[model samples]
Target: MNEQISLSAIKNGNINAFEELFRSLYPPLCGYALKILNDSDLAEEIVQEVFYQLWKKKEDLLITSSLNSYLYKAVYNRSLHLVEHKQVENKYANHVLNDNSEIYSIQDAMQAGEIYQIYKKTLSQLPHRCRKIFQMNRDFGLKYNEIAIKLSISVKTVEADMGKALKAFRHSLAEYK
Candidate 1:
């Protein structure tokens, strides 16, 4: 049947004419939506929704063009809306991820600063020779042999001082762990 005849019948509340329109137009509408959406299921769903809306609002609907034009336009707009909505959701997700990474980096920097302060306080409590040896090894990045040579001390004495410094730091900083 012609679209005009089917549309007029549907407007007059003819169920058979409505069924005929659905049978004829449903496939082409789904195909059109599929071309826009790239998903068969979503395309079919959009077409079905448009048809449902057409039926539900048939009495109040105003069409200046053919029924085919109206349905195609509806499907096109709905597909575009879905794509826009998905893009917005993806952008929001990326923003949240970036925000979380920034927060994590700030927290890491603050924690490092706190640990450095604790370490400095602990170093102050060590005996002068132990503090110097630890600083030479850790802060100045010197080897044990280099520190021993620089300080005119035996390697064994440097090792013992390093051990004492480590024991002190571990004792004072254990609460953090």
Candidate 2:
């Protein structure tokens, strides 16, 4: 069940060869995923899914390096994606349920905390003026011109700061996946 032997078989159209590969590598891959996800069942599911996808698309499989590395990377990426999706869904769910509070997030309390921390950290990295404008627009739902008058800066500055803030948020979130 050497990886090279299995990979050769897979590339040559012997799809079942990957069964041994999957059996051998599944645990470590799941372990790597658990480091980020910290959920054993979720980690196992992600690792299983990674293998299922690999087998489903085996015709286009390419192993530039070792198969183990590819499997590990694939599982890691899938786990990260699962976490990120939960965050987005939680954001929508936390919408104002009542006058009490916006109950945002279905993925437990810890994930909500992490998402808030990431948002806070990214906001902190923005230029001070840009951050203020962004908060005014997003938090208070202010119009661009209104924010301009309130901040005593040009409307164009408000627009530009919003743009910068958006770019920073997108860039920071891109790494989360």
Name the candidate that leads on TM-score: 1
Residues 51-166, model 2: lDDT tens digits: 88887777788779777667766765675576666632233222222211222222222343344557778999999999999999999999999999998999988988999999
- Model 2: per-residue Cα lDDT at residue 143: 97
Question: Which residue runs of candidate 2 sit more than 4 Å off their true CA positions?
Answer: 87-177
Tell me model 2's lDDT, rounded to 2 decimals. Answer: 0.69
TM-scores of the models, in the given order?
0.48, 0.46
Off by over 4 Å in 1: 87-177
What's the number of clashes in each of the models?
0, 2
lDDT, residue 113, model 2: 32
- Each prediction's Cα lDDT score? 0.76, 0.69
The top-ranked prediction according to lDDT is: 1
Model 1 quality (TM-score): 0.48
- Residue-level lDDT of model 1, residues 1-177, one tens digit each, is 777888888888888988877776677667665655567888899989998999988988899987867876787678667765663233343443435345223334334434555776799989999999999999999999999999999999999999999899998788775
How many Å off is the CA of 115 in candidate 2?
34
Model 2 TM-score (2 dp): 0.46
